[model samples]
Each structure stands twice: as structure tokens, then as C-alpha cells.
Target: MRKYWFKVEGLMFKERPFCYLKFRHFIMIVVLGCFLLTNGELSSVIEIEARIPQKNDLFSNGKMDSYDSLENRKLLLFIIDFNDFMCLSCLDSFLDFYYCLPSDFQKHLSWGILVFNISEKEGNNNISARIVEKKLRGFVAANNIKFPILIDKFHVFNGLAEEGTVVMVFDWNRKMVKRYVFPLNKGQIEEIFKFLTE
Candidate 1:
């Protein structure tokens, strides 16, 4: 190791040969550390086998009905819509990804929206089931969302809370392949697309 001495304000200080390089490296490391520290945990694509939620008849064509009889069938792609209405960022992220999906690709999938924090009326007040159903219909119609919106009253298995939304990808046999929280990154979207195609 080599040392260089420099004087400033009548005081002598010693620095390594590549002091500037070392400083730059230190700053880079610190910036990376801060980025990771602040960004909380990000859900990664994972492989897992699981069963599809059996609770059904929660939604249909923008209407909430009793847990009426529902036929069970193999599902290719299903989104567990555990989206809180207040979490606009998460909902926006999911909508962007969903709307951009290819038309043909969209048809081959079944969809559902699970409302965790229900706010059908103003001032964040709780509303009746009929009112909620009407609001859900208006929301879907207003946003052109072509999917069933299910309330999470039964607490059907979901991974997101009021802070964010979880986007899950499941196979035909009802096994969850990946579950990513929004806002989803490019890599996550790509991974989901690959799974959907394959």
C-alpha cells in the first residue's frame, strides 16, 4: 500500500494512493445499501404447488350473490384480487399490466377481485352488501374491468393487505407458480408472461 500526504490550512493529512477511487467505491456501496434498505421486501418469482380456493359464487357480471352453486373446473390463470380500494397505486399497477395483456392471451384466463377494505359509500363508511355490489358494478363498468370482483370476507387465501396488492399466477391444476406484489417490475411481468404462455 502507498500513502500520499497533503497539507490544507497548515495541517497535514495522509490519504491512500487511490483515495478518489476508494471514495467513489464507498459512495456506490452506500447508495446501493440505502436503496435496498428503503425499498422493503419485494416478492420474487417462486415455484410452489397449492390448491385453488374452493369458495365460489362470490361474484358474477358485476353482482354479489350468495355462495350459490359453482361448477369446479381446471383453471389456467387466475388472479386473486386482494386489492384495497384505497391503495390506488397498487390497483393502477395491476390495471396497467392487465390491460396491456394480449387480447387472445386475456381470453384464456379467469379473473377475480377481492376487496379487503370495502368503502362503498363516501367518508370511508361501510355500506350494505347491495350497495357494495352496485358500487362494484359501477367501478367495473366505469373502468371497463372485465372480471369478477370478489369480496375477501371469507378471507380466502391472499398475500396482500391494505398497503399493496398481490398478483398471483396459478397453473391449471391450481398450483401457485408465482406471487408478486405491486407495483410489479419488468422482470416480474416477464416471468408471468412466460408462465402464462407456457
Candidate 2:
């Protein structure tokens, strides 16, 4: 039974008796806030282009190349937490999935791993940057990972997680198609292959 009024351009307009004007205004504000937060639009998919440092490669003679040059290549990015002792399972899944992929499918897609050690003290050592880089290189050598393994120098995906694994799939057009958090199972690997084939 309460009446509400709003001012527009120095003119006051009365609300209908049946409507809750205050509640309606609040709803409008919330909707507008979301719109503004998303830059007046929202999308189910997002495009992400990672920045690859020029001299950041553990292998390839310390030269890291950008994937931007590959215009028609789909990317499967595996992001891992280097500090987590238990997260090695994610890397194991990556290896299994990679080796099982058909040659034709491998030609169409490129895969890479970027490990991040977010903590100041990696494992039990308060190591310097040089020592950390050496350790990372050793890991790559030990595993004999065929794909590129780069350290997440820029923290591009820090928001995703600071202590886990995240897998991101991007199409040739650089639009993100899907994301999977770890312990990515065999079913998820199959799903990724299906997505790539499609």
C-alpha cells in the first residue's frame, strides 16, 4: 500500500499502486551494476593469448617462442603448481593423454605446460631464481616432456589457482572453448579429444 516516486529530469513520476517501486529500483541497480562490470555485455566464452617470454625456455637453448605465429593451431594449455608435491598426478595425466593421441590429431593441436611456484619458499628450500630455474629444467629433462615447459613468469593465471592444476582449451581463433580443473581423468581426456575433432 506504499506509494513510491522517482525524479527524472526535474520531473517526479509516481509508481503504480500495485508495484513495489523501491524493490524495482534496487533490482534495476543490481542489473545495471552487473552490466557495467562486464563492460555492458557478457559472454560464455573468453579469448586468452598468453605472453611467452623470449628467453624463458628451459630447453631449446633458453629461447621461448610465441604461439601467436601459428594462426590455425588449437592450444591445450596445462597449468600446474610446481610447489605442490601431490600435483604430479596432473603431469602424469598430461603425458598419458599426449602419447595416446593420434598423429593426425597431434598435428592439428599444440600442447604446453606452464608450471608456477607461487610460494616464496619452494619445497623446503629458500632458493634463488637461478637455482629454481635449474630445478625446473631438470624436471623437464627427467620427464622427457616433448612439449614446451615454461615457468609462469607473469602470473597470468594466478586467479585460476595458486595451488592446483588447471587445463584450458583454446581454439584456432584463440577463443577459449573449455577449462578443466585437476585431477583430470580419462573421461575428460576423451572429452577434449572429442572437442578437438569437432
In model 2, the runs with Cα more than 4 Å from the true position are 1-72, 85-90, 103-108, 111-113, 118-128, 173-176
Cα RMSD (Å) between model 1 and the true structure?
Answer: 17.0
Q: Against the correct fold, how does model 2 do in TM-score?
A: 0.49
Candidate 2 per-residue lDDT over residues 45-141, each given as its tens digit? 1112233433322223334345555445456676656654345665676556666766533322444444444455444322433454566566656
Q: Per-residue lDDT for 1-198 in model 1, tens only?
A: 123233441232134446666777899989977886887332222112123433342234435444233222222233434344445554787778878776533432445545444445544433443454555565566667654445544344344443456665655433455667777899988887776665
TM-score of 1: 0.47
**Which one wins on TM-score?**
2
